[model samples]
Target: MRKNPVATKAPAEQVVKDIRRAMRKLHSSEEKIRIVLSGLRGEDSIAELCRKEGIAQSLYYSWSKDFLEAGKKRLAGDTARQASTGEV
Candidate 1:
């Protein structure tokens, strides 16, 4: 009996890595803000939300922290302004 040549399997590590890579989603700033806000709403547990979003809890926390910090700085009028150059 002849064996099938196309029945080979990839390495476990490589398969896992590929899945992780494929699972990564690129979100825009608006989408990120929406996600963070949803987490803050507390309608569901953080773990559940993370699972639904396919993201880690740590990532959600990081985004929340950055969003709050930016708001704080903006409220404090700490925004950066570009310097105007005068022609000589």
Candidate 2:
């Protein structure tokens, strides 16, 4: 008789990966900005802040980079608008 592959339980590693993926946290834009701003304040070491926030240093750095780039783009847009208004 042929065995049913689908009826069998998943492998331990696959089960663990599935659980982790399901349990992953989703951060809101506001939450991300707050965290980035906190890191920028320099009240605590980046490593310490990450540890307290229950996140990795790489994740913190990624958020920080995104936040700064967005601000820079917004400021540039504002400046261009101001110059155009002045010309008119």
Candidate 3:
């Protein structure tokens, strides 16, 4: 009797890790800003927004906090000065 090579499989942990990595979503900065702004609009509850966007409430809050802090810094003109030369 010949063994079937097709029946071979990777370890369960490795398979799970691969599946999780594949399922992970990479959102662009624009998309992140949009989501944060939407949450701030108050048109919907934060929990509901998170649910609709498939993110955790905590993640939404973290993004919101970062967005607000950035705006605050910008309004306060606390931005760092850019180097005049592009050369390293």
Candidate 4:
């Protein structure tokens, strides 16, 4: 049997709360991607990060892809609505 690491088991509620706090400050999809990666770095586990963030591995991967592509494709797409309506 594999032994579970003492530090590896994370409470679901705690993870959700932590992710929520990170989410509140993130306004753009780009920012969300950054926060998710930061969370992954802190935990260093995709499964663990997915569990805490209340999202599936697919979503995380999808978002990560968007984030990396954000540098080139994000600004114009990100501000379109705001610029059009003058919301930003």
Best by lDDT: 1
**Tens-digit per-residue lDDT, 9-82, candidate 1:** 44666789999899889989998998899999999998998999888899999999999999999999999867
Q: What are the per-residue Cα lDDT tens digits for candidate 4 across 1-88?
A: 7777655656766799898888863347655666567765775688877776667788777777776676556655754333545654
Ordered by lDDT, highest first, the candidates read: 1, 2, 3, 4
Q: RMSD for each model, in Å, please?
A: 6.2, 6.9, 5.0, 12.5
- 7 Cα displacement, candidate 4 (Å): 50
Off by over 4 Å in 4: 1-31, 39-42, 73-82
What lDDT would candidate 3 get against the real structure?
Answer: 0.86
| lDDT of candidate 4 at residue 76, scale 0 to 100 | 59
Task: Estimate TM-scores for all models.
Answer: 0.66, 0.75, 0.73, 0.45
2 against 3, candidate with superior lDDT: 2
Full-model lDDT for every candidate = 0.88, 0.87, 0.86, 0.68
Put down candidate 3 lDDT per residue, 1-88, tens digits, no spaces.
Answer: 8766555545666789999999998878798899998987889999898999998898888888988999999999999867777753
Question: Any idea what lDDT model 2 has?
Answer: 0.87
Pick by TM-score: which candidate is best? Answer: 2
Q: What value does the lDDT take at residue 36 in candidate 4?
A: 69
Model 3 — which ten-residue stretch has the worst lDDT? 4-13
Count of backbone clashes, every candidate in sequence: 0, 0, 0, 0
